[model samples]
Target: MTHLHRAFLFLGTFSSLVLSAAVSHGQSCANSDQVPLTKVKLEEIASAVGIGTNDVELRFEDFALETVRPGLPIPHNNRFFFSADRRAKAGIANVVPDGVIPLITITAIPLKTFIHSNSVFYESKAVRRTRLPPSYQKYQILGFLDALEHSPAGSEGSFVPAIVFMTTSDVKAISKKTRLLATVQGVGILHTIACEIPDVLPTENNLQMGAAIVVNPEVYILNISFPFPSPPGSPGRVRP
Candidate 1:
């Protein structure tokens, strides 16, 4: 057989192998379902926050997820804030009260599995230095919360603290630009609740709100009647 023919045969075999591997991976991912949160888990998470099982619900307005990329470092997650009515009713609403929000978050990453499977080129400095995408970081917080919230009631578990976790690079980047209270709308009754770090150090690594509500002490049962903040120069109440 000619050298060129032998080379072609080897190349064809390599291509076929690559294609097969790709197809297998695609199938595996397609079959994998994103785990769902269960009711039991939610109760556990609530209990951790010093609330009874009945006091907690998975339903929170503006539950969202955000992504983080390298160099641009900010930590965010799928967060749930009480509505004004619920906040009042729950008696956990606070406006800049000293303490942390009694909330928890969890996170998971599929890329870690990918890195584990493909050992080759995994140990490179670049790969080692690379951080989990911002979305994954946020998701980790959600996952942890979800797991705790979904765990079966009566299961032996402790409440997880609210702390933002990220790679050192990301943390440094966030420290420079991040604010203690991130004023956001869509919290319904809890709209005024600020997203701030807890006074305690070495807290859970992620965005967390204090469990206690103090802003409008007179108001109990945060109803969904509050208005959202207005745009710049618009005739509306500015979010503090």
Candidate 2:
């Protein structure tokens, strides 16, 4: 299908998804007429892609971008709350008078740099509700790599090679430490890190990270540097 047609289809599917989610909230439901962004006159788009003037600001949030409480005819304003970043590209547009085509701005933010080896790896003390699975097998870690890198490789260009963590059943379980994972800053589309452990957390090395993967900057990272400080009488040295 055409891009515009697909965009509209996405809108419909998205709305239906929202309605389904809201129903789970135990909130009363009602059908409200909504307008698509096509009504606002996207200069790049030569013709109307949708009907109606009702539109909501799209913000990347907790489960991907969508209105706060969609399917309801309520006024919600989406003010530009993004700042400059070298890794992310921000886009802006607005509704204007029928005779005027408003100016739009797009900016890219750097969300990947924060995930690099140099960033902070906060501990549980930082306060978080995310509890990953107790143990993640090698296959799981590689699954993540496959999704991120499209395949595990050390090619000429790609996000930094993903370190696959070995299986471990508990946080205290010393499997191995490899890299320094960091939580960054901002409302981002970050995946909850699950499963695996490093053989050794890098204390020194030219360890780099992916250049532009969009992710939340406020997640958590465990500060891992050295032969991990294990419990009393336990093997402190990283297992080869």
Candidate 3:
């Protein structure tokens, strides 16, 4: 099948999963619409995803260059709020507790950075309400190398790797400290995080937030020195 066909199939499957989840949860089957997700619930969900409450925050806006750049034009919609290192210190945290906050801890690469890194992973499968079998022994992790070898051009890029936690019986038996593994075909295995939170949470255009990869920036040395001016009328322009 063509890459376009695969994408369609992939999206269709995920759509079905979301719809099924909404119906199963009695969220909004009457209008064929899903229920809205809440911030408190998102925190619970993120926590269940194996990250601490302080480690993950829900983001509702597109990332801007200002995050990595300064003195740039910042387009604040006033609709989305973000809380983080400098943002929180700037009183951005007074807006809402669940507004976009840091999803990882200090010293860990930011979620945006991870999304743009080469160490990211992803899962293409739709999660169900059923429990993952204790005897289940297969992997479903998709990584960068696998994308290079398998994903179609223009589509092989970084994405937030999401793993769904089942809210059924099997999860209850697993300890919160225990980490499960799910492998992707031809790829590596991802640590499966089990949360009791349901999938009925609100989503933007039906797109639920996925799991995130953690990365660290490279260590580099900075040599700071002012350049000496050349003789008068030098070919190079000098800073005033």
* Model 2: worst 10 consecutive residues (lDDT sum): 118-127
Query: How high is each candidate's TM-score?
Result: 0.18, 0.16, 0.19
Mind sharing the TM-score for model 3? 0.19
The Cα local distance difference test for each model comes to 0.22, 0.20, 0.24
TM-score of 2: 0.16
Clashes of 1: 48
- Per-residue CA lDDT of candidate 3, range 1-240, in tens? 999999788666655554343224321111223222343444444454454554432122211111211233223323322223223234232121111111111222342322222222222211234233422222111112223223221133222222222121222222211122212111111221211223333221222222211110000000011111111110110011
The window of 10 residues in a row where model 1 has the poorest summed lDDT is 118-127
What would you estimate as the lDDT of candidate 2? 0.20
Deviation of model 2 at 108, angstroms: 14
How high is the lDDT of residue 186 in model 3?
A: 19
Candidate with best TM-score: 3
TM-score of 1: 0.18
